[model samples]
Target: MTTILVTGGTGTLGRLVTERLRADGHEVRVLSRHTQPYAVDLREGGPGLDAALDGVETVVHCASSPRGDEQAADHLIAAARRAGVGHLVYISIVGVDRVPFGYYRSKLAVERRIEESGLRWTVLRATQFHDLVVTMLQKLAKPPVVLVPAGVSDQPVEVAEVADRLAELALAAPAGRVPDMGGPHVRTFDSLARAYLRATGRRRRVLGMPLFGKTYRAFRAGGHLAPEQAVGKGTFEEYLARRFGQ
Candidate 1:
């Protein structure tokens, strides 16, 4: 069995990835900032990183914050190189290259670093997660009137499906930049917010706001969409039903 180390193993996607790998009978090590024995802060290059990488043949990097991802990736890459890890797998957003947002830019930079790190690597870009979309809707619904960006849409995918795909990729050979994974439908932000409101039994007037900015324009233009790669089967309504019950 291959020994694999999963960074951010306690996170939403990473936790599922760890479970999948362990179920497949691989020796899996979970590394997080607070997890015991493998606790290592990737951002600051904490002390226990080297120990976690010991005998690890593959690494699934799922640990990411809003900021400091590049520094974390650099530290992880250097540690992986030192430990002679063979394969480095990264999970990224679908429009990191096309979207000009700061977080997207950081994700793109990490992708590039992994590509040129002189190590076998694979990168998978996926659409936004259902949880993130829900969070956005929650914030928008806080006000009496929900104000969503006009003309912007989101293709929300299941996090479990993403984790399953990552596990499969980790077991296979490094195939740099695999096919993008997208949700079943591309719905407008307004529709998704309405879905959330319905699921939670909240009544709110949803309005579209025409925000001016390159980011908003890019989102409106669907730079973040992967219409050709709508591989996910879960729908927002289904997710809501499962999460909040019928």
Candidate 2:
């Protein structure tokens, strides 16, 4: 059995991927600042990573901040390379190339690093997740004012699906930049907020406003939705149903 080291094993997406890998019978190890069975911090590189990566056939880089832009990924990439890790699988967001978001630019930088590293690698680009949806709901909980981008859209997918896809990548040849994974339905902020309200039985009103900034403009241009590459089975309705138990 191959040993797989996961970087962000405690996170929503990372946890699922690590669990899947462990379930697949691979010897899975977690890499965090906290020492455990096996751990390595990306911020500080060295023999620590080498020790954790011993006999590791694959490295699933799920460890990252919400704003995992290039500058952050650089250290991660350097650490992985120094460890001589075999297969490097990166989970990235969709529309990084199309959107002018700093986070996306950082993600793109890492992708370029792996491409030029000569190491076998796979980059799985996916859309937003239910976590983002939940967070948005909380952020816009104020009554009579759920401010949102007037015309921006989203196709949030299940984080579990993204995990499964990452596992599939680990088992298969590095597909380079793989197909985009999106939710079952295309929706606007208004629709998502309404669904969330109905799901939680909240009576908050939504205030649709114009999307500003380069990021907002990029999002409004449909740069985030990947109709051509979209492949998912979970819809927002089902997500709400499962979340609300209705």
Candidate 3:
């Protein structure tokens, strides 16, 4: 049995990974901001991490900043190496290389750092999750007309799917930049917004607003899709039905 350390274990993806790993008979430890025995924050380079990583053979790094956290990734990689950990698995967004946005750029930098470290690592790139869809719905709720960025296509995935894949990676040998993981079907931001409105019985016009910059261009170019990679199971309709139970 391997000892697994999962960062951001309290979040949606992290919690699922921890539970799955625990159910698989592995000793699982979580890290958070609070000063628990195994929990610590990554912003300050995570103090007391030496004790947290005691006997840990594998690390599933699910922690991240919305604006991206390169330093946090750097620190974790360095710490795991110093602790003589066997493997490090990182969860990344799908469009890092294509987008080159600040956050995506940070992710790429972290990925490069891991590759250059000569340590065993696996980087799993996943499309946006259902949670992102939920967030969009919440935004639409505020405005009578839902203004969305134009020309962006996505195959939004389930966070659980991402977690399961991370767990699978934890068990497999480290392979850099594995096949991408995405949702069941492709749709635009407009369609997603419309689906949410329809599901919630909210009447709103989804206005496709023009976008600018590399971020917008990247998304428009299908940077958010997994063209030939792993496809997710849950459909947006299925997700809404399960979430709303109707």
Candidate 4:
């Protein structure tokens, strides 16, 4: 069995990836900021990190922080190389390079670092998670109306699906820049808001607001979608039903 290390093991996608790897009979080490079982903050660069990477054959890096993404990636890659880790699997977002958002830009920068780390690596860029999209709509839903950006589309894949794919990649030989994974269907922000309203038995009007600047324009141009690489089978409706039992 291989000894694998998973960063951001407490987050949505990272948690599922950790579970999948452990269920497959591999010895998994989880890294976090707190003083938990395998606590090792990427920013701190503590000695616990060396212990965590010791005997680790592969690293499924899912840790992400928009403010310090580049530094964190650099540290992790350097540590892994020093520890002689076999492969490094990185989970990225689709259209990170194309999107003008700061977080996306940070992710793109991390991807480039991983590619040039001089180690075996695989990068999988996936669409947004279903829960994230739902959370966005829920947060925007107000008393009378849910405000959404006009002309923007969402192709949200399930977090578990992305986790499963990451697990498979961690076990196989490193493949640079693999195919993108997206949801089964792409829907407009308006339609997604309406569907969320119907599922939750709310009748809030969805107002499509015209947003300006490069971020909105990139979203409207479907920068976050991969129409030709829609590999995930989960749909937004099914995710809503599972989440809300509607």
Best by TM-score: 1
Question: Considering TM-score, where higher is better, how would the candidates rank from best to worst?
Answer: 1, 4, 3, 2
Error of 2 at 98 (Å): 1.0
Displacement of residue 228 (Cα, Å) in model 1 is: 0.3
Which pairs clash inside model 4?
none
Candidate 4 overall Cα lDDT vs. reference? 0.91
Give one clash count per candidate, in the order shown. 0, 2, 0, 0
Can you tell me which runs of candidate 2 are displaced by over 4 Å?
66-72
Measured on C-alpha atoms, candidate 3 has an lDDT of 0.84
For lDDT, candidate 2 versus 4, the one ahead is 4
Whole-model alpha-carbon lDDT for candidate 2? 0.81
Computed on alpha carbons, the lDDT of every model, listed in order, comes to 0.95, 0.81, 0.84, 0.91
Can you tell me which runs of candidate 1 are displaced by over 4 Å?
Answer: none
For every candidate, C-alpha RMSD to the true structure in Å: 0.7, 1.8, 1.5, 1.0
Candidate 1 minimal-lDDT segment of 10 residues? 45-54
Q: How many backbone clashes does candidate 1 have?
A: 0
> Candidate 2 on 133-229: residue-level lDDT in tens?
8788778876567887799789989888899989889988777888788887788988898888888888887878885698988999989888776
Q: Taking the tens digit of each residue's C-alpha lDDT, what string does model 1 give over 138-232?
A: 88899999999988999999999999999999999999999999999999999999999999999999999999888888899999999999999
Q: Output the better candidate (1/4) by lDDT.
A: 1
